[model samples]
Target: MRAVVIEQPGTVSVQDVPDPIPGPGDLVVAVRGAGICGTDIHLLDGELPYDRYPIVPGHEFYGEVVDVAGDIDRARIGRLVTVDPNMPCGACAECRRGRANLCERYEALGVTTDGAAAELVRVPAGLAYDLPADVSDVGAVLTEPLACAIHGFDGLPRRPQDRYLVYGAGTMGLMMGLLAADMTSEPVTVIEPNPSRRALAESFGMRAVSSPEEVDPDERWESVIDCTGVVEAIEDGLGRVRRGGVFQCFGVTETDAMVKLRPFDIYRNEITVIGSMAVHNSFDRAHRLAQVWGDEKLAPLVTHGYALDDYAEAIRTFRDGAGLKIAIRPGGLA
Candidate 1:
């Protein structure tokens, strides 16, 4: 099998590797489509922890089941599916509380283990979700990220006519905007400096602004989500939310980044500041969204596609501040 391995920091290579085989309660998937995520960039930059060097790095992907372990039905074989990349220990306190996403013993695919940036990958059967017939391979590949966004929204209290603002028009921000649009009529604004990204956000019928300066200081958002993971965006977004409004930090920032906020501001405003990590109890919801939203909704996010062999180029395209979502088709897309 051909796999792209990030041997270490500042290193990536496509090399022949042994095909992944299913373990107990596991399934082997023939990789179809995988997408680059911001976390991947962090991993590459040595910001995120992962297994030792030479790991295949991709978690958001869709594939056909090539094989399965245990007594699972044969019907599952050859079925198109997407996976919940969070592997949780059932015995963990978090899992016992039905919060598997925050499992005390949790290992993420592509992060703790080898991922789908290859010809084949093995994952837990329990983590796999069947893809709807109407869902395209690309959309299926995006279910993971969408699930994360959906979970974040699910955790937040959203009002029907609440004015909302999203910081960062990247994959996570755009998904947040799309989801928020379906739930609220209040103008959903996206703040991003990238012209291409802002244009893309506008094309989705979202109010896109190049900076916070364009947004009226008096215009207070009912809710604000910072997906940029930058200190500046976080501080600025906090100031944009209305009194008593909720501010959700959905992006994972660098460990060293910090922002100084007035504690009195939070106290006086009675604002609620929350951090949303990965998806929990939202993978199925995400799959359902992917199925119903169809290509019409998912189409807006996919701005580039690359062959698996061109892994470096794909990573560069994503890191270049260009596309909203870049797909990595193992065999390349037509």
Candidate 2:
């Protein structure tokens, strides 16, 4: 099997590797579509503390089951599925409290082990969800990220009729905005520095602007979400939350990053600030949502596709912000 291997930080190459063999209770999938994520870039740059070098780096993916082992049902072979890459230690204190995303011993497929940026990858059968026949390849590929967005929403107050202000118009930002629009009657406003991204957001019926200044100065949102993972954006978003409103930190900022916020204001205004991590029990729900919106809303978010051999180009395109969602087709397009 050929895969994109990160030999170490700042070093990556496509090379032939031995095919993955499923262990007990696992299945081997023939990779169909794998989406490149910011985490992949972080892994390449040694930005993430959990990432392992000499590892394959794709987690947002869907594929066909080619083989199964142990107690897995043989009928699963040939079924198209999307996998939840996070495998928490069920006995951890956080997992016992139903917050598996914060499990003390976290093991994500792409980050901790070899992943789907190859012709074949092995995954635990329990983590795989079968996709409906009508679900498009693009929709299947987006399940993971959509699940993360859903988890992010789970952390919000979710007050009915609450206005939403989101920062950034990238893939995650756009998804967050779309979900916010569905949750409220009021238009969702997005702040994106890139004109092209702002245009894309407007095309989806959201109010898009290059900066917060473009919005009414007195405007405040009941729910403010920062998806840019940028310090400046986070600070600006905090200031735009309405008194007694909630602010969600949905972006992945630096571990040591710090921002200025008056502790007194949080208490005086009764503001709620929360953070959302990776996928929880939202993977199956995300797949169902994709099935509902795939053709109309979700699928359109995918703007580019490259062959597995073109992983380098895919990374370049992603870094350049050339498209909304970029997919790597390991088995080529079906």
Candidate 3:
């Protein structure tokens, strides 16, 4: 099997590796498509902590069941499936409370264990889900990411006429804007410094602003979402949200990063400051939207796709341009 392994922090290589075989309760999935995530970038940058080196680095992925055992449905073979990525200990306090995303003993597939960046991967059968018939393999791979955005919005009670602003124009930011648009008559405003991403947002009928500093003070927003996870961006967004409105921090910043907030502002305005960590009961929501809308709504976001051998070029494409989503068809579907 061929795989891209993270030999160490800030290093990676595509090489031949042993094929994964299913364990008692595991199933082998033939890799099909994998979506690169911001977490991957964080892993490459030595930002996010993870297990020791020589591990396959991937999690947002889709594939077909190649082998299964142990009371599992044999019919899953050859069916396209997307991974849940996060495996929680069901007995944990968080899991018992139905908040598996925040499970105390959480293990992430690509970070804590070897992931689906190769020709095949073996995972616990319970975490695999069949891709809806109407969804493309590429689109199905985006479920994890969309689920994160869904969880971010879930923190607040949304209203049909609530004016919202999404700060950032990356894949997560744009997805937030699009999803908010679907729920409200109030326009969704996107704040992105990148001209290309701003232009891309414009094509989708959303308002785009280059910076929060440029937004008129008179402009009021009921909800503001900070998707960049950058400290500066999060701080700037706070000042724009209306009194009694909600402000969501959707991204995690560096450990050392700090944002100075005025407690008086929150006290006087009755503002709600919330943080969304990860997907919780959002896979089904994203899957339903993917099934109903198909690829058209998200096609604009997938700016480039590459083959397994072109992983370097794929990273360059994402780093150098304002492309929303860069994908890899590990099995040549791209």
- Please rank every candidate by TM-score, starting with the best: 2, 1, 3
Quote model 3's TM-score. Answer: 0.95
Q: Show model 3 residue runs off by greater than 4 Å.
A: none
Clashes of 1: 0
Q: Provide the TM-score for each candidate, comma-separated.
A: 0.96, 0.97, 0.95
Ranking by lDDT: 2, 1, 3
Query: How well is each residue in 106-161 modelled by candidate 2, as lDDT tens digits?
Result: 88888889999999999999999998766677779999999999999888878779
Which 10-residue span in candidate 3 carries the lowest summed lDDT? 132-141
Q: Model 1, range 212-331, lDDT digits (tens) per residue?
A: 999888888878999988999999998987998999989888788888888898999999998887978899989878877878878878878888999999888877777778888886
lDDT of 1: 0.86
Q: What's model 3's lDDT at 222? A: 88
In model 2, the runs with Cα more than 4 Å from the true position are none
Clashing residue pairs in all predictions, respectively, total 0, 0, 0
Worst 10 residues of 2 by lDDT: 291-300
Candidate 2 local Cα displacement, residue 42, angstroms: 0.8
Winner on TM-score between 2 and 3 is 2
Name the best candidate (by lDDT).
2
Off by over 4 Å in 1: none
